[model samples]
Each structure stands twice: as C-alpha cells, then as structure tokens.
Target: MRKSMPEQNTVPTSHEVGSFFRQSETSLFAIILICGGLLAGLAFLDSGQHGLSLVGLGVALGITFMGFQYGFASGWRRFLQIGDGSAVSLHFILAALCALVFIPVTASGLGPSGSLAPVSVSLFVGAFIFGVGMQLANGCGSGVLFSFGGGSGRMIVALPFFVMGSVIGSVILPTFLTFGSLDPIEIGASLDLSGKLGLNLLLLLGAAGLFFWLGRRQGFGLTKRMLGATILIAVLCWAVFMVSRHPWGVTFGFTLWGAKIANLIGLPIEQTTFWNWPGPQRALTHSVLSDTSSLMDFAMIVGAGLWASLSGAFGKADWPDGAQLFAAAIGGLLMGIGARLGFGCNIGAFLAGTASGSMHGWIWFVMAMAGSVLGIRLRARFGF
Candidate 1:
C-alpha cells in the first residue's frame, strides 16, 4: 500500500510556460533595441551628421524605459511611492558610484555642473523655484522626458513650456550670474588630502547609508530588485559617459533647443553672454541632431513611449483644467529659470554634480528639497 502512493506532477503548468516566454521575449526585444540604438548613434556621430543622431538616442532611451519598467514591476515601486525619499537617495548613491568608477578608470571629467558657482542669492532663489516647479509639473528634467515616453498625458503639455522657459532662463542667465556669485568650487580639487578620491568615496558611502536608514524609517525599505535596478542604471550612466565623453545631462539640451527656436524667429540669441560661449555657439549653429543632449532627450521620449505602449502603462490623454494648466505653465517657467541660475536641474546639478564631487551639488540638493516641501503644499491647491 505504501508503494502505491500517487505520482507527483513534475511538469510546469501551461501558464508558467507562457509567462516565461513573455518575459523572455520582452528581454530579448529590449536588448535588440538597445544595441541597435547605440550603434545608430555612434554611426551618426562618426559620419559627423550629429543632427540625425536622434534616431540612435531614441533607441538608447528605449533601453532606459525598459529598465524603469523592470524596476517598477519588480518590487521597486515602494521606493517611488509618494513621500518616500528612497528614490532621491538612490540617485545620490548611483552618482557617487559613477564618480568612483568612471573618474579613476576612464578619466571622465566632472559633470556639467562640476564647475560650481558661488552661493549667491540667485542660487537659493532659483533652486527654490525649480523645486516648486518640479512638484507642480510632477516631473523634474529627466522625469518629464521619461514620463512623456511612458505615456503620461500631462508631461506632453509640460514639455513645450519647459523648453520655452529654459530659453527665457538662458536669455536672463547673464543677469543672474552678475548677482554676486562666488567663484565655482570643486571639492576634490580644493581638498589637500593625499587620497582625495578615497575620502570622497567614504563620504558618499556614509551619505548613502544615512539615506537608506532614513528611507527605512519612513517605511520604504529597500528591496533586492531595487538594488539590482540601481546597479543596472549605474552601468547605463557609465556607458553614457563613455560614449558622450561627458556625464549625462538633460536641461542644457533643452536650453539649446529653445535658443535655436528663438534664433529662427529673429531673436538675437547669439548676442547673449550665455549663447556667446563657444560650446553654446557651436550647438546653436548646428543641426539639433548634432547636439548630444538634444538627441538623447528626443530618444528618451520615444523609447519611453515604446515601453509604455508595450507594457500597457500608457495613460489616456486627458486635458487638464484651467487651474492645473496655469500651474503647469508657471511651474515650467520657474524650473527653467531655477535650473539656469542654479547651474543645472536635479539631474545635472544633484546627480551629476554629486557624482563629480562638486560642492554646489550638495547645496542644490538642500535648497531644492526645501522648495519641494513648499511646492507640495501649493500643488494641493491646484487639486493635484
């Protein structure tokens, strides 16, 4: 009787098999898109037709979108839930890691925000305004691009205004610079320590640990999947640096795009001090696809869109009410001005700046957070 025990079912259920295939297909498709996109961008760069590089940039963004989807779908959503600071903490950690690895190994220079400006009155004011704008728009610089790619209707509305605001900010940037800014400060350069890099690594680790503890206390405990996603994102950031020969940037492209449009419409944008710079001048005179930042920005939006559509994450386009629209416009304006005055937005200033070990990045983070609190309060009035 004991030998007559029922046989166990060893085979996987049909549903399990189907799920496996779906996941495999998704992963394979993402890989193909990423590889193809990177190749296309490189080819364009080699051909010296930088303006057409958007095709490649879009593909790269698609990869990033897939990464985000993976993170969100894989128990990482908790860190992104409202009121959780884990996302910001993760950003800082990734930046520090980037600095540690890329700077020493690849000899990567500091991020765009590495050249710090003095702690002037405009710095505080601009950061505060940028923070408020980010909350109201429900997106920062990268956030907006990714959100738009991910089928967020609101972001579509916010994107153009963001561009316009950036242009305006660029136009007025000279005024802000003249407002008594101290010379830019670089932490690693200024320090006299024998092992400056080692000290930076230690400090960054301490900050990451502090943020992790704080996030856990706030009920946003880190998960294994989130850690994996962070590692992947770090790799992507490194790749970007290797390819672009500069750390990742977003808003500078926005400013350039805006300036180009202005110039097309008979605005003497070239006369401005900001645009008179060699880099800005070159970008202005060339095709948009030639600008790495703009190309990447465009690609990110397309990639996000593809991901959102495939993943069923795309939201329907719902028009906002008058108050919400007003808020969006104002928010875009503030973010534009704030980013220019503060030397960069969250991505450029906080993430990239911190990764580069710039003191200004830390300053931007503190002021922006303060602004976010107020922005949140204001956002509620607009029924967000």
Candidate 2:
C-alpha cells in the first residue's frame, strides 16, 4: 500500500533529505561538475583547433546551470506554493538574464563563421504548435525525458510514441511544406539595425528591460537555493546560446531514437532527416542534426534522467488510463509533428526563442498556452 502524504511527511527527520536526494531524477550539481569539467578539458586541449566557440561554450554552461536551477526550484516547493506568481517571477529573472547575454552576442554579429540567418513565420507557426504540444504532454520534450528518467512510467510509454510520431511527421512534412506551412523567418528584411551597435543595443536594452519589468510585476523573489539555481541556469543559457551554433534542444534525441528504431524495424525511415529510406545498411551519415553534439544532447537527457531517478526525486508513475493513454499517444504525436514542423520544442521555441529575441517565439508561446488550456479541458471532460 502506498503511504499517505501526511504519513510520509510526518516520518521525515534523520534520513529525509538524503532519501529525497536519492529519489530525485539526477544530481544537478554532479552533472554540472562532470559536464563542466569535460567541456573545460576540451577547451584546454583544443585552444588552437577551436577557439571554444563562445556559443558552444555557452550551451555547455547553460545545461549545467539549468540543472542547478531546476534542482533549486524543485527543492523549494513550499516557498513556490506561497504564490503562483513566484514561478512567474523566477522565469522572468531567468529570461532577463538570458536576453541580456544572448541579444548582445547576436547583435554583435561575432561568431566562428556563418552569416546571420533570419527567424521566419514558419518558425512562429511551428513554435505555436510546439507550445500547445508541451502542455498536452504535461511536460516539454526535455521534461518528458527527465520524467522518464525519474521513473515516470507514463512518460516511458509516451516517449516511444513521440518518436513514432516524428517519423510519421517526416514522411508527411512534404505535404505540409507544399501547403505552405513550413516557411522560414526573414531577419535581414525586417531588422532595421544598420549602424554598428544600433539594433544590437536596442535589443539588449529591450530584452533586459522587458524581463526585469515582467519579473517585478510578477513578484520574482527567491530563496537562497532558488537564487543559486537561477544564477546557474542563467549562466548556462548564456553558454548554450554562445555554443551549440543554434539553441538548446531536447527533441533531437527523440528524433534520432525514432529514426534508429524505425530502421531496425525495417520501416523505411530516413537515415538522415527522418523522411528517407535506408537500404542494405542503417549506417548513420553526417547531417547537421545527427553528429556528436546531437548525440551529446541525447546523453544529457539520459544522464539527467539517471541522476533524477537515483536521487529519489522521481515523481509517481501515474499511468494514464485507456482514454488518457489515447490522449497521451495523440498528444505525443502532435508534439513530435509540431516540434519537427517548428524545428524545435518547448526548449527550442519558448526558451530558445525568448532568449534569441525572435518574435515567433512569443507567438508560439501564446498559441501553445492556448492549446494547453484546451488540452486540459478536453482531458478533464473525458476524465482522462
């Protein structure tokens, strides 16, 4: 029999904290230490080969920092419960921190190579669908991976379905593209920053002010632990933006896993973009999204999940009933399709978009929230 909530709380004294840590998904501090050290070592060894691509360096920093931030957030549940606004406040603080760093870097137009690529309307539409999918799944792509790591049995089922959906999505993406749903955002035309620092300065100040004002209005105060976590995540976000050549992503893992699974099953899955056929051998070839760094993302989620599960921070399995299961499956499918269509997920759209100053991010966020609300309503009505 499961212990009652009251019973569990009353019997906690000597080994409570230790036990909780043990049950948590993964040790953020440990991940920070390990990953940070690895990246640092790489930076040390290849000072000449790669100048520690600031964006890549930033991403590494962001991942570890976010682990700490989430750890702190989850630890202070009592404080967080004090006000719903508290969560908003923390996001504001984190967002502001990210915007300040990322905006300036992008505006500066300094990087290893590659000209600036514009954010597009397609990105916005994709983002909106992605957001809606996150709410429906009751977690973002990254959240699902961690939830599974933390022993979320329901998420475990959802993950595979998510991959399948992505494969299906890849097959049908051509149709969507033909229908004109997948267009890119034009940056060069819309932006008016010509003078050296004109646009960059405006964006930097705008991002900082916007997040700060939002935070103030939302009452973004924090306990020491949460403060520490926030700082860690802020730094990490900065690093990710500087490194990964794009943004922090979580769905790529699902995409790759899905591709691999399909190939194994002889389902004619793309060895590259999840849309092509693999004949004779399922040999993985070089594409922008399937390289070492892509695999690194896969490892991070698995690693984080492992850490969370061992720490006793794992939530209950809470398997969805038949109806809820159906919802979950469909939701996961939408998420996969939407994420691919948008070229990202919650982390990709909202988190990355907000940090990058793309207006599409904001649009996707609103639509996704709306979709989530609808999903919740549907779930409730059906008792799922």
Candidate 3:
C-alpha cells in the first residue's frame, strides 16, 4: 500500500506543456537574434573602415525586417497578388523618395556607375524571362533571401538553382551584350529640371500620383504603420547612398558568388567579358566581406530570419510536390539568367535603378510584370 501510494503521475499538465513550448520558442527567437547580430558584427568588421556604413545598413535592414513582420499587411502575400497593384506601386513610391533625398545630397557623384545597365533587346528579353521566373519560383532576389530567412522551404530549393543560373548567365552575358544596346539614361542628366524645380520633385510627384491611383483602384489606403515604415526605409536607403556612394543593389553579389564558385571548379570566369571589367574583376578577386552589396545581402537574410522568428512567422516549411519542386528549380535558373542579362534582379534593376532615375529601371519593371503574368499562369498549371 505504501509503495502504490508512492507512485506519482508523470504526465505533464496542459499548462506545463504550454509553458514549455513558450520557453522553447523564446529560446529559439533569442538564438536567431544573437546569430544575426554576430553576422552583422562580422560583416561590419570585414567592411574595412567602412564599418559604419555597414552598421547603418544592418540596422536599417533589421528595422525593415521588424516592420515587415509587425507593420506591413500580408508582407509576402501582397507581393504575390498580381491582381493587386498596391505592393508594386508602394515600392516605386519608396524608390522615388530615396531618389528625391539622395540626388541633391550626393550631387550626382554616385560611384560604381556601371550598375546602371542600358536598355537593349537583351534587357527586354532577359527581364521578361526573369519576370516569369520570379512568379514561378515565387520569389525575386530579395524575396528569395527574405523568404528563406523566414523559413520557407520552397525558397531554399530555389536559392541554389538561382545561384547556378546566375553563373550561367554571367558566362553567356557577353554574347547578349554584343547584340547592341543604348547607353544608360539618367533622367537628371537629360533634363534641365534639376536647376529649376528639381528633377526629384517631378519624379516623386509622379510616383505619388501613381501610388494614389493604385490605392484607389484597389480600395485601400496606406496605413499609418505602413507609411511610417516606408518613410524609415526611404531614409535608410538614403543613408546607404551616402555611405556607399551608390544606391542599394542586390543581384551583383549573386553573380559574384556564382562566378567565384565557377572559378573554383576550373571554369574560365576570368575570361568572361563581364568579369573582365575592372569593378567586376575586383569584386570577383576580393574577399566577399569587402563587397558592400554582398555584405548587405547577407545582413538582410539574417535580419529577416531574426524578425520572422520573433514574430512567430518562421515555421516549418510545407513539403513541395514533385511538379512544384521542378517548377521552383526551373524558375530559379531563369531568374538567375534573367537578372544577369537584364543587369539586375528586381531590387537592383527595378527599385534601385528607378530610384537612381535610370530609364532601364522603368523598362525592367514593365517587362518583368508582363513576364509575371505569364509566370503566374504557368505556376497554376503546376498546382502551385
């Protein structure tokens, strides 16, 4: 009787179980943030004296991740809603604001001028293909990084292929460039408006008008939080310009990574026309930490992961079906190639380009959107 009385219940109570889960989740979130901070710190140290700028970028991106998690409405979901023009239009507005702030401040001394790709048959072709690919893969360059950080399994599949595609694109880019293209067009350069009313004003006004129209059409208005986030991001972009002496960019890092891998595997990356250029060559030869764009990209992914974990947005990813997996791989390849041929992915070519007043940005946007429509249709066929 005394032995039987000594037997105690071993099952955890519901409250105990709940508390355990909460503690585990909190621990996981803390780990992610700590890791992100470490990565950012390493990137800053590796930035060689430009550590301040890297720090600025890391903090800004971290804030942006938090905003995406807490402020924005349906962050990733909005980007995929082709029928709703809000997300695209709002981003354009953000770019416009960045341009309005940085142009006068920088006095047009933005270095690394080669980031601006000229309009050409290859650009249209590549952008169109990229557009399709983004839709099929369900992520753009920035999108893929953030989605992966947010624990999306599909994006993980797309990432490697995207890198491979970028390498292939770099290999073939010289051929595409030989097809002939126009010189890069800078709006401020061609117009006398910068002297009188300021060209940035016109650009900002036009973007604002478009945003308003799109919002009305969609029966939505920018929330206070969203507006605040946009303003913050715009300022961050301006800071990036001030420090880096160039607008924000993303895909170049991918190309660099791809080329490096190719080089390591006995590929003649140095012989490629694109890599032969001074800037590209320097990036290819140097440590990745010294590459500003690459550092920012790395920070962005870590920041996204940290924020997603804190917000409970990071979760186990759903398994993809065979067809879906195939679509992701193919889409990633197309996106990689398209990004190189078109001069950038969505962030580089479209957002940064437009903000910097390059006509190619507008061209990339139109072509990519058109491609997106087709991509969406293709995605449906794959039951995505």
What Cα-based lDDT does every candidate model obtain?
A: 0.68, 0.52, 0.72
Query: If ranked by lDDT, best first, what sequence of candidates would result?
Result: 3, 1, 2
User: Candidate 3 — which residues are off by over 4 angstroms?
Assistant: 1-34, 66-83, 106-115, 193-200
Candidate that would win on TM-score: 3
TM-score of every model versus the real structure: 0.79, 0.64, 0.84
lDDT of 3 by residue, 185-281 (tens): 8766755537522665576557666756766676756667766777777777777777777777777777788888888999888887888889999
Residue-by-residue lDDT tens digits, candidate 1, 91-177? 667777777655464333344223345666667777777888888887788777777665454666778888888888878777877
Q: List the pairs of residues colliding in candidate 1.
A: 50-289, 50-290, 51-289, 51-290, 58-299, 116-184, 118-182, 149-304, 149-305
Summing lDDT over every window of 10 consecutive residues in candidate 3, give the lowest-scoring window: 69-78
Model 1, global lDDT: 0.68
* Candidate 2 ranges with C-alpha deviation above 4 Å: 1-89, 107-128, 181-227, 271-293, 314-323, 382-384
Better of 1 and 3 by lDDT: 3
Clashes (candidate 1): 9
Candidate 1 minimal-lDDT segment of 10 residues: 70-79
Model 1 residue 278 lDDT score: 87
